[model samples]
Target: MIAYSRSIRGIERTEAYARTHPVNRYAAYPLTAFEQTPIAGTQGNRKKKEEAASQGVYSWLREAGQGQKLLGELLEKLGRHNGVASKEQLENSVHTLVDAMNRWESAYQSREQLLRPEIWEAMTLAMRHPAMELLGIKRGGQEVGRRLVWDPAILPQNPNMEEVNTLRRVLLGSEGLLMDLKRALSYAEQYTPMQLLRQPFIHMYPYVLYYGAAQAYHPLPPRGLIMNKTV
Candidate 1:
């Protein structure tokens, strides 16, 4: 299983800290942003699980199709959107949609930031293997020349709490994620991205496409995340 790190100071503890210090705003925007977003119903969660399971078979075409469908729906809705209604009704409807999108975006971004420690830990685990020096996505706090496409150097070095948060923002943003994913998929290997999708770690899921391509060759890649040897 892809072991994700549990929070030492969970949301409740952070809330308590915030409550204790009234004036001290928790500037960790990603950490404390959407504590109240509603989780999806079982059906929705199951659908995600099913989709992921389908992707685990190295079917990039199918996975891309699903993503395209979702994006198409979102765009179709946006294209047809018209807020015309009774003043209060229009306000309420628009507000609801805006709020939903905001919550989703915030929550999605938080996954990476919240799980930064686990990502680092996973990288540490990956580094222990000698092959890491060659197969690793990063090294010496920078992108290795082995995969000379997208620069993982865009990420932080020996990421501290603050730097980790920034790295998450850079990597987890919709555009950034897609860009790196394209680079990873540049090679023509089917199972390259599959292994990444199958990881039990939540944070590592997004990275499957990015690192999967780099480690697509024989001797196979490690199950854990690759690191830059920062630690």
Candidate 2:
């Protein structure tokens, strides 16, 4: 299993710091007063910008939520099967997951200011390796067993407080599921489905617990709040 002790400790430290230093009231409104209130003939342009920003936020939340849900479903399915899933099923699930991730990433990129820069950077980096792995799996054949080509620039960065904690919990849970699936794929190649059946179900309680806790946290901003800002 991928050890998350370091990540967890980092999250705890960040949370403590956040407790001591609260976000500024105006941090959420990055736009200047002039930008916030459209002047004269710029009303039409400002209206379009607000609409786009609103849509971007909506898309990000929708796609991110869908990806999380799909990840949970895949984990539950793997737990049920004892990590003996067929390659085809794994490929399909990974494809869907990657697509949703891509959509959300695009949405987030369009509105990076919606989230704290540190949080956005952390999330993007956290997603890269798994996304590469999942894409390789989707391509099948020699790709599935290939080593990850770690990017030198993809180093870990500090995350902001409660949101960071929620993100880390979700990332760890998803990473565990991805690792399990990759292992199962390897086993499938060596043994027939019948032979794979004898393998014991890997306990997935930790993944389930992490995912459950992250869900309870609701890291994303409320839709109404986001809309209000755009308006």
Candidate 3:
């Protein structure tokens, strides 16, 4: 086409070339989509299924709560807190921290990132949807908006190991994930302070509150994580 267009390629075959060979098609990039597994246990995957049966959730929550508790104190000390973190920062952090740690050898094969693309695919699929959907959280509104609150309370239902694993893969394959997350949360605070105190206030999760404690004190203490009332 360009060859026949004088304006594009300095050629003069315009009418002749077009009539002889009509352009009929275009190409598109492949959709790198994830292949999700069913909730039901399948053959050879029993272990992965039962893994969900364990009290992994309770343990995770306990640990997370402890982390948040600590984070709350830390924030009070730093005087840098405003409110609960918006969904974007939380999402970014998940990718950043896990990816940074994904490089090490794991116990299983599919669990390993060097070979399996499914792990990344699964997460990419989840990310395409709101993070809340796969996690079974009560989701509303759009995360891409200027503000979207991530209520820790809405996240404990579904084991998001698959999602987390995906983040680990991306972050591990490259560097700068963690720092990127930190900077994102920080920038959101600066550019859109409302990002911290916006609508749909999410109740803070324990571990996050503890870890980010230094970042959530005073005017925005862990206790005030859920601003749904006044918010």
Which residue pairs in model 1 clash with each other? none
Q: Candidate 1, after superposition: displacement of residue 96 in Å?
A: 0.6
lDDT ranking of the models:
2, 1, 3
Candidate that would win on lDDT: 2
- Candidate 2, residues 44-106, lDDT tens digits: the string is 866886576556545544555555566567666544542223334444555565555455445
Over 116-143, each residue of candidate 1 has an lDDT whose tens digit, in order, gives 2332233234223332222223333244
Those runs of model 2 whose alpha carbons end farther than 4 Å from true positions after fitting are 1-39, 83-85, 112-119, 128-231
Q: Which consecutive 10 residues in model 1 have the weakest lDDT in total?
A: 222-231
> Candidate 3: where are CA atoms >4 Å away?
1-52, 80-231
Q: After superposition, how far is residue 147 of candidate 1 from its true place, in Å?
A: 35
- lDDT against true structure, model 3: 0.34
* lDDT of model 2, residue 131: 41
The best candidate in terms of TM-score: 2
Of 2 and 3, the candidate ranking higher by lDDT: 2
Q: Worst ten-residue run, lDDT, model 2?
A: 193-202
